[model samples]
Target chain A: QQQVKQSPQSLIVQKGGIPIINCAYENTAFDYFPWYQQFPGKGPALLIAIRPDVSEKKEGRFTISFNKSAKQFSLHIMDSQPGDSATYFCAARRYRDDKIIFGKGTRLHILP
Target chain B: DAGITQSPRYKITETGRQVTLMCHQTWSHSYMFWYRQDLGHGLRLIYYSAAADITDKGEVPDGYVVSRSKTENFPLTLESATRSQTSVYFCASSGYFGDKDRWYGYTFGSGTRLTVV
Candidate 1:
């Protein structure tokens, strides 16, 4: 079964605009939620993460808004730039579990 | 220099041949994992090791084998390459769960693109 589900397989937005990607997971045991950014020909890198205890987290222009009751989380890119265009992945993990489950992905494009 | 690395960034193998992808890390992290990325399926774990001499299967482990002989090395071998095996492979390492402060998240190697013909 798909433990995590993501929407908007692809997205496009103008520079300086805000682009959001959403994800929902089924497992309440998940305590860690992280977002990863991947440029073509490169591996995905951790962008930002949030714990279930908090409702939101922000790092630079990236923010993660999480709703524990809804089992949903979303990543928002503020004042996005063309440099931000890439594929993004949302992942979840249990506190002590060694494995991380990843969502399919969203390919984002920031138009210059 | 202190990061995970994957060798042979690209490879092409004939069907039914044996191919192996190598992964190494300098941080000596206790957990290492292998994942395959497909166009629509995202990253699916194939195998993982919590430490040397310990390994376990992930979502997809058929026709593939993995061995972790030392703390730094985890190699994934395809016993018989098939067209379905063509995909990008990634290796990642992380500190144990107890080190939450140090576990910003997994540190991933670039990736290895494999093609089976």
Candidate 2:
């Protein structure tokens, strides 16, 4: 079964707008959540991550809002730019599980 | 140069042919993983190696084999290529994936686009 579910197969927003992507997980044991971004011809890079101990974490213009009770997390990109266009993937793993499950990716586009 | 790298950036082969994909990491991480990316399927793990000579099968390991001869090299082989195997392959490395440190964000290599006819 797919453990993680993500929405918005494709997203488009204007420059300087806030773009958000949501993800929910079925396994309550998952304690670590991370988001990755991939460009056209390159490998995916770690963007930001968070743990259930906290409700939210922010770095630069990227923020991950998590809800432990709801078993959901969403990524917010503030002042989205054209350079932010890429595919974003959400993943999760139990504290001690070496295997991490990934959600279906969401393609984001920023219109100038 | 001090990160994971995948070679034969692109390859094309016919069905029933054998093809191998190479992955190398300089970080000397304890964990290395292979994943395949397709149009509808996002990224599916094919195999993962915790250390040299120690490997395990992932969700989609059928029709494939992996060998970790050395700490820095993990290779995946397709015994017989199939049209269903035509997808982009990615290799990743991480230090440790458990509760300690709890940082499992991976360092991925440039993908290898394999096409099986």
Candidate 3:
């Protein structure tokens, strides 16, 4: 079973617009949630992360809105740019465990 | 000059042949992992090592083997290649998860694209 599930396998937004990608998880034991961004021919890099204790976290133009009770989290990109086009993945893990379960990923595109 | 790296950025092999993907890290991180990414399936873990000589299976381990003889190197071996195994493989390293203060997120390598014909 997929521990983490992501929606909208692909997304498109105009530059300067906002694009949102969402993910849901079943494991309540999960304590850490992180989003990764991957460009073609490159490995996924950490974008931003949030702990369940907080409702949201932001870094630059990226924001992670997390709902602990709902077991859901979403990534929102503000002022989306053409360079933001890439694949995004959401992951979850427990505080004591070393393994991270990743979502299926969403490919995002920004039209100039 | 110090980071994780994958070998043979690209490789092509015939079915039934043996192939191995190599990964190395210079930061001496205590944890190393192998993951394979496929279209629509995302990235699935193949194997991981918490320390030297301590290796464990991940979400997808069938038809794959891994070893951690040294702190810096972890290699994944396919005893017999299969068409289904063709995908982009990535290696990542991180500090001990037990260390809450220094638990920097995983650092990934450039990845190796392997094709099984």
Candidate ranking under lDDT, highest first, comes to 1, 3, 2
Q: If scored against the real structure, what TM-score would every candidate get?
A: 0.97, 0.96, 0.97
Candidate 1 residue runs with Cα over 4 Å from true position: B96-98
Which candidate do you rate higher for TM-score, 2 or 3?
A: 3
Best-matching candidate per DockQ: 1
Give one digit per residue, the lDDT tens place, for model 1 in A1-112.
Answer: 7899998899999999999999999988887899999999999999999999999999999999999999999999999999999999999986666578999999999999
* Local accuracy of candidate 3 as per-residue lDDT tens digits, B5-36: 99989999999999999999999998899999
What are the candidates' C-alpha RMSDs?
A: 1.2, 1.7, 1.3
- TM-score of model number 3: 0.97
lDDT of 2 by residue, A29-112 (tens): 787899999999888888999988989999999999999889999999999999999999999976664577898899999999
State which candidate has the highest lDDT. Answer: 1
Every candidate's lDDT? 0.93, 0.91, 0.92
DockQ per candidate, 2 decimals: 0.84, 0.81, 0.82
